[model samples]
Target: LAEHVVADSVLVPGVALVGGGPGDPDLITVRGRRLLAAADVVIADRLGPRDLLAELPPHVEVIDAAKIPYGRFMAQEAINQALIDHARAGKAVVRLKGGDPFVFGRGMEEAEALAAAGIPCTVVPGISSSISVPGAAGIPVTHRGVAHEFTVVSGHVAPDDPRSLVDWSALATLRGTLVLLMAVEKIGAIAAALIAHGRPADTPVAIVQEGTTAAQRRVDATLDTVGEVAKAEGVRPPAVIVIGAVVAVGPDQQP
Candidate 1:
């Protein structure tokens, strides 16, 4: 079930940024899996399909990148340096991330670091949780007549935070699906922002926790009530929060 990703085309002493897809181990792309199998050293993030690590050969070195949500984590610089050090030693290093590496995964930063260190880097795309998670919950991000566009945003920062780049006011005006990742802690503020920005308070919202995994569960609410609903339901991290009419298009209808 494995083969060398580069074979003769790319050389060793390099890094492969492989997206491990959403939490399900089987969701990873073949290319990503192949790369992982070929790696001599794997630096993994906490959010990906970590169970796959057990499949690696005993000789492989596995380093925990420890990107736990708002918790103790290996600093980005440390992770970058670790990749560089291993690759510099002529080892095939794989940086396995959850969802698409470029989707709020901080993959570009790592790639840039490798480039500056004169290390070769290859990217393997993975399924992003933004779409797959919602889909797993029976929610289509876009529907024929319900929605035509969908916006994916990071909710790590609250709408009122000075560091936040999302234009909540603008987002509220768009009549499309809104997908929020890393936003569980701030769902109340997010929902409030949208409502304050003129979005209808009654817009349907769905919070799918642990999406795509066996532990997956969903809670429903209107935009005005999502914050409270999420709290009452104990919605936690690694969850996908979807907002808009598309939430109503799924098999389950709000009561």
Candidate 2:
């Protein structure tokens, strides 16, 4: 296959954006694992199934391309340049990210950069935490006769931020589920916005931290108190915040 593929010029040096899947190493797709195993170099983010990195062969060069939204990390330009540089050198480069690369993972930006630089790129979709995390906690993002739709948004910035694009008022009017990733830091403000925008103060909320891993823990509260409860419980980043009645439909719910 290797020689036959080379004869047709089908196999070329390029970058693969592989989604590691919500934190669980086993959740990664088969294709993603295969590409990861064959990669010559891997640029990984802080999230995702990081434990899998330890399993890589000694010859596989690993680069820490972690970019924490509000924290110190590598610049996006540098990460793109790294992929271009490595692939141009005839190496199989893998850009491993947590969850689906296009789901707020900045995979598109990297792909565009690679394309502009004349490098080939492939994307491997992974399970996003927006749904998986809630599911891991036994809470379905969408439940029949409960919630028929769900919306996932980034809470990296407060709703009041000038650069923020989310319309908190519209979100408040949504009768479906609202899943907020990276909102631990701004949960207080987000919850306040939702409540102020018309969401009931008593709307059910669930905050799942380090979801899908052994360290997972959940804190339940209402929209009025979720932020304070999350802070008091020491919920940190990398957690998923679920709002709406669907949160009350988890397997552990009481009658």
| lDDT of each candidate versus the true structure | 0.89, 0.88
Which stretches of model 2 miss by more than 4 angstroms?
A: 1-13, 67-74
Steric clash pairs (candidate 2): none
Question: Can you tell me which runs of candidate 1 are displaced by over 4 Å?
Answer: 1-13, 67-74
TM-score of 1: 0.93
The sequence of per-residue lDDT tens digits that candidate 1 reaches over residues 1-255 is 111355445544479899999999999998788788888889999898988999999999998887423234358878888888888777878999999999999999999999999887888899999999999999999999999999999999999999999999999999999999999999999999999999999999999998888899989999999999999988889899999999998556756
User: Model 2, 1-255: lDDT tens per residue?
Assistant: 011122333553588899999998999998788788788889999996999999999999999885423234358988888888888877888899999999999999999999999887788899999999999999999999999999999999999999999999999999999999999999999999999999999999999999999999999999999878987898887999999999888557978
Model 2, CA-based lDDT:
0.88
Model number with the top lDDT: 1
